[model samples]
Target: MIGVNDILSPGMIVAHPDRPDWGDGQVQSSIGSRITVNFREAGKQVIDGDRVALQLLSAD
Candidate 1:
């Protein structure tokens, strides 16, 4: 199934829907359902696009 994360790409800023404490994160990479993000507080994290719909903060 298609998801919002399917539109995410590198350089985009996003926030974890569940982990607000993680702070805003930058899209490092997105391949298939795997998304790598570098958060201000959580550091690098691998998120499953199929599971978590990251909230878009900035397109650039």
Candidate 2:
């Protein structure tokens, strides 16, 4: 299980498990239980860190 302690930060890339429409997103901000991601397709979206398990994506 991913938690806030997993060390998420700005510029990190991630994918939403249930929101493919949003496409890949770059982490913009992480504060407490809220995470802001700027996606390719869906623009900026604020996700609940406690409720969503975001998949970390590699730049490679």
lDDT of 2 by residue, 11-40 (tens): 889999999988999999888878999999
Error of 2 at 47 (Å): 0.4
- For candidate 1, lDDT tens digit of each residue in 17-57? 99999999999999999999999999999999989999999
RMSD vs true structure, all candidates: 1.1, 2.4
Pairs that collide in candidate 2 are none
lDDT (C-alpha, whole model) for all candidates: 0.96, 0.84
Best by TM-score: 1
**Segments in model 2 whose C-alpha atoms lie over 4 Å from true places:** 1-5
The per-candidate count of clashes, in order, stands at 0, 0
Global fold similarity of model 2 (TM-score): 0.84
Candidate 2, residue 60: the lDDT equals: 31
Which pairs clash in model 1?
none
